[model samples]
Target: MRHFWCILLAIAILPGFCQALDIKGVHYLSLQEVAGKLGMKTRWIQQDKTMQLESAWTKISFEVNKRDMTLNGTRIFMGYPIVASRGRFYLSESDYDHNIKPILTPQLSGAPPGLRHIVLDPGHGGKDPGAENKSIGLKEKALTLDLANRVKSKLQARGFRVTVTRGNDTFVSLENRAQNANRLNADLFISLHFNASSTTSVSGVETYAFTPNLQPSTSRSSLHSSDRKTYPGNARDEWNTLAAYYVQRSLFTSLKARDRGLKRARFTVLRDIRMPGILVEGGFVTNNTEGRNIGSASYRDKLATAIVDGILVYKKTLDRLAK
Candidate 1:
């Protein structure tokens, strides 16, 4: 009988239903607000299987489940589990779209939110010749700048605001790189470089985060225990951990590159920056074959996409963890 009455009530309300009002912010409406909007009274019965709402000439009873919600004794599907937050029932966007749209006229197409600003730092410039491969004549500084530009473009397309440390051929100091990030309040920092080795066979991608204990000398010669040149403490540690986990994972998954799991070391940009910073050794420029591949425009674009995807994945994980 409850189911039958709910069906009748739904039919009565169907013809006069108006489009849903715009929902602002990132929160859901309360049940009382939902009832008032729908012109129905809602009640909670002590029995787990049944609920009652009395308003106007109708009384409705429905059963609530972990994955489903029944209204007027009618079973309704839910996209995610029903959650109660702050003493109010909450449903995801899926539930609102699938279950409520038939009765509510206004519908919105879902678009993912844009990411916060990203700071791209091209490693080495001017006097700094990071690495060189004879075969393709790829210089680490030039390649890093090119790759950084490509990454900036791709990230822009994916709705991320992008800024580069050096737009052209001029060199930017390590201090300026971190300062730029601080000025922009960037969310992610990526520094691009290519690796070199005495052995020509070394090839693969490696990502580094910040480590207070692993601070190396400015010349990369020997450990400077007494240098007293260490910058601030692990200010960027949290961001680096997130960056390392997401970037390293995404790079290997998409590019099928070797996994050089997250490592910590003293990279000026990573250590001084206030945000999550990562330095990417795209591939071994010392390797004959890998240098050729890194020089290609197509491969650079793929690499950019991988980095962007990693940022997105990290963003999602952060969102989930925040809840």
Candidate 2:
């Protein structure tokens, strides 16, 4: 039954009209290889004691009290323990997001200290079934995860460190979600979310970033200014000012979806994060045509590819600016 569903999800990513992505040479590490590469040994400590391993110049440990885990003495709350699979300790993708990646990659860089750690948050999970596309019988949570996973795969292939908020159909709170990003000091926080309208007439793709340090009224006024300037409109008018300018732009080219234009708004997830953050409203699930497309494996794959392209573009812009 699960395999049947997996196949369906895989099919949905192939958006028929879009060009296929070049996804070659993506290497994922096994738990033991990940541990061994760092010169750490995995031990099954049955006592109330902690299990610690040293790797990549970082010391990692699992706490006996609760699921609390840490690396380099920094605390990370894991909802699940690292499991041993095939004689090696394997960390679930979701667990890696909350526990391992936080300590491994804390900065965003283009081949500097290392590849940037990205947090791909699939908004609305478990009981909170975000928007529903009745036409296709697709739940927003399912679509979000499907796209997030695909994005993760493509990015991994392209040599970027990626993390996902929810790996399965489980509930995760906003606070915890933000905390994961905060703890990791993520280079970027990209939240995957689909739109829904009661009228079913609305459809388009929009990206959002939190208002700058300025007050809401002031920001709103600036957004409405005759200059026609938009969000992240800095005094210097820097490139990609909307926080996701390049990403949103690249996405439009890849997905060929409606361009709703980037905007500024107060969202709980984006506001508190320190790094550059953007929330992607892919399309409206309420609209019949879009709902079905969102439910398809091919389209979801394109969506994921579009997102990965955006991130790569953002990285290139950052590198140029840094130089």
Instruction: Give the number of the best model, judged by lDDT.
Output: 1
Clash tally for model 1: 0
Q: In terms of TM-score, how similar is model 1 to the real structure? A: 0.59
TM-score of each: 0.59, 0.58
| Model 2, runs deviating above 4 Å | 1-115, 215-243
Candidate 1 Cα misplacement greater than 4 A, ranges:
1-115, 212-230
Lowest summed-lDDT stretch of 10 residues in model 2?
Answer: 17-26
User: Mind sharing the TM-score for model 2?
Assistant: 0.58
The C-alpha RMSD in Å for every predicted model, in order, reads 17.7, 22.6
Q: Which candidate leads the pack in TM-score?
A: 1
lDDT of candidate model 1 versus the reference: 0.63
Residue range 1-323, candidate 1, lDDT tens digits:
43355346556774222212122222344445566655777677754444455566544343443544543323333334444432344444434443443223121322222248888999989887779877678888888888898888878887778899988777789988988887898877889888899999888876776653333322343345633355542554444555565676677668877664445567678767776677887888888877788888888778878887888877776555444
